[model samples]
Target: MRLDLGAIAKAGTSKANQTGSWRNFKPIFHQEKCIGCSLCKIYCPEGCVTMVEKKKYTVDYTYCKGCGICAEECSSSDIEMVMEEK
Candidate 1:
């Protein structure tokens, strides 16, 4: 079996570069308000939002661009959109 490694596969090149600065807004997750809908995870463009538990999710800010896709897609309004603070 062969592994499908794409893009910068080197550890140095991949870990040294971060992509979180490309956003004008950031998404904040409300654990209490979340309904385990999983919409945020599906709509995240960067795939930074991951389900850490049955009803909880975590965002990897290292690569998240503050896109509001997750917030917009959230039917329960569990994700809130806020301006990114420099």
Candidate 2:
């Protein structure tokens, strides 16, 4: 099966929008591993994690310090800390 390049491009754009500040810091959420628990949101000292909807969370790196607390406290091993590309 051939891949749809347009769809891939759109998906990339959507991911970029969802993950703001791609140049500063990034939070990689492993959805398959995420158990829909809100521990990350609770442990985030910066209060950057927000529930966009039920069972869905987003990190606001615009204020995040890349402290990795979310990744550390994620019982499901879903959250990961990643450095942003310069």
Candidate 3:
């Protein structure tokens, strides 16, 4: 019997995995406190952060792994890391 390796994965396949539950801590954005430095967007490993309007940024939690890189890179202390709820 020949092994059909070609049938393994289909093209443009989407994963059903949700990683938000894996986060120990979540980031809280303080929009008012943000200085529009773009540091959070620049440093985000997952590229979840996006610019909304003229220097303001918004984070998409769907792809965020809660690595805290955004919080660490925030020179204005705009992004705060808080523990995730069970």
Candidate 4:
């Protein structure tokens, strides 16, 4: 017998699973350095980054996978990835 599985994952299903629990490094947002370009939010693969205000952004650790995409994509170099204490 053969099992059939779709190639693409269903949309909005990732929210049900919290993938941030095992991340070794987490992205830190610097309020002062941020230029509010929204690069971090646009590049996040897990869709964990969010905009708090016009020039401010925050990350939802519950769904963030610590992939460093946010930090790399930051136009102002405001996001930093630091080792998780736990």
> What's each prediction's TM-score?
0.77, 0.63, 0.76, 0.80
Task: Write down the lDDT of every candidate, Cα atoms only.
Answer: 0.81, 0.71, 0.81, 0.85
Model 1 collision count: 0
Give per-residue CA lDDT, model 1, range 1-86, as digits (tens): 45566643545565455788887888888877778989888888777789989889879889888878888888888888788779
Tens digits of per-residue lDDT, candidate 4, 39-60, equal 8888888777889998899999
Best by TM-score: 4
59: Cα error in model 1, Å: 0.8
Model 2: colliding residue pairs = none
Model 2, 5-46: lDDT tens per residue?
Answer: 664544434333433443354678766677778998999876
> In candidate 4, which residue pairs clash?
none
Cα displacement (Å) at residue 10, model 2:
40
lDDT of 2 at 18: 34
> Arrange candidates by TM-score, highest first: which order?
4, 1, 3, 2
Where model 2 places Cα greater than 4 Å from the true spot, the runs are: 1-25
1 or 4: which has the higher TM-score?
4
